[model samples]
Target: MGEAGFESRFVAASDGLKLHVRVYGQPRAGRLPLVCLAGLSRNAADFDVVARDISATRQVIAPDYRGRGLSDWDPDWQRYALPVELQDVLTVTAALGIERAVFLGTSRGGLLTMAMAAVRPTMLAGAILNDIGPVVEATGLVRIKDYLGKLPAPETMEAAVALLKTIGAGKFPGLAEADWRRQAEGMWTMRDGRLAAAFDPALAKTLEQVDLDAPLPTLWPQFDALAGVPVMVIRGEHSDILSAETVAAMAARRADLDVLDVPGQGHAPLLADARSIGRIAAFADRCDAA
Candidate 1:
């Protein structure tokens, strides 16, 4: 077993939603917890590879946001918006008596981290923005919107594995057959021998409101709040979401902020690989020390 024993629990969010939180690591280490936030549509298990690789000195809590993963689907699809997600994050921490934590946020999770900076700056000890930045490109976002809630049912787990291989070919290449199966297992929920989206299909409505054609909003001010704290930004080399110019500007503004660009990936880089895991472990140790 890892230093922090793996366990699952249902934590009550402010809105009475019992969000599922999967924990890894030692909570009594006297260090601020390290919270893993998944992408918009993904869940706690998205951090399975991440949680195992991080240091055992601090706690790691990964939660399935409102309408996704093991969490109960919201009857009102509008409740699946960012505000509710952000509130749920705060509520989860409060329930666990965690006053502060290092935020490792991916994609939509990164937005929540920034939003927290805007609303509750003191709650974060540090933050690592995984393949995301304040200035998100519309083209990439549009592509995400296209895939949300579109997963079709697969007749068998083998068929699901095949479908996962075909769909993730461009984003995830050089993956072994076993790794592909693992990805599929973590992504879909099987019921009655059929595969379904792990999340509620209605949550798709919340995504339709995203206006991709408009100019990206300025988010440096929200990000600047973490200037004094340790900040690391991971970017995929081929990503359309975060531009090179914006990253350069961020580095110029904050000397402590580190920027790492992963090659041969686009949109987002999966942190499951050994190289990516090592980087995260080092960053977490640095954050623990800070």
Candidate 2:
């Protein structure tokens, strides 16, 4: 165990892939365990800040999808689809003896939460979606597609930080240099004496079918499946993915929804900030009470 008080667990998926699941803290007597899911191309490191804090009162589990982080890369890139990823999440949680959990998903993680609600409703105690919804904006997808697997590998940590700030400073204007630096550290890793993006480059294959000119499929039914549970959405003020229109639609469907808009951020709000995390911690308390 490291200073974060989290243990690294390697769980085997049904397909025989090895997955990394970070387990943090001891379970509180009454608090529901929190399962964190990261975005596309992101890894377990993304949850380092929030889990370190949230795990103080309740257990937190953050899993890296097969192709990201320390997990084994899938031989068939097509297995990177959500169905496979969802199975991996279930497998990891089950291995950890977690029958149910309050899911906190960021970006692609949020999508998996909805899928979980549809296929395994009993496992969902509550949900927190960070800047993602049934209706994903194509513009945001385009932006992500343009950069995935194409980022330049910088020679040093400082160079990596500068690259991130140069590319991301516009959307996440609220983030400080220190914030960008941390992001740099998490987004890349050293391998073969060279710095590279943390995720397998083959992940780009999954986006090859995305049609920029066409509307992507929506998951309103999946979102609706969570109507019985407490739900919270944390959106960036400048987010291009979870639009205001979609949020209004979500609210229309479920009026009890808790929405937090983080100013000066875009697409997804980093739950790393004290204010954002405090709200999430409070939401967890309510989930426990419910």
**Candidate 1 Cα outliers beyond 4 Å, as residue runs:** 1-5
Tens digit per residue, CA lDDT, model 1, 69-94 = 88988999989888899999998888
User: Candidate 2, clashing residue pairs?
Assistant: 239-267
| Index of the highest-lDDT prediction | 2
Residue 31, candidate 2: how far off, in angstroms?
Answer: 1.1
Query: 1-290, model 2: which lDDT tens digit per residue?
Result: 67757899899999888999899998778989999999999988888889999998999999999999989998889899999999999999889989989999999999999999999999999999999998999989998999999998999999999998888788888788778887898899999999988888999988887777887899889999998899998889888899989988888988899999899899777788999889999999998899
Residue 243 lDDT, candidate 2, scale 0-100: 95
Estimate the lDDT of model 1. 0.80
Q: Give the best candidate by TM-score.
A: 2
- Model 2 deviation from the true structure expressed as Cα RMSD, one decimal place: 0.9
* Candidate 2 displacement at residue 177 in angstroms: 2.0
The whole-model lDDT of each prediction reads 0.80, 0.91
The residue pairs in collision within model 1 are: 4-25
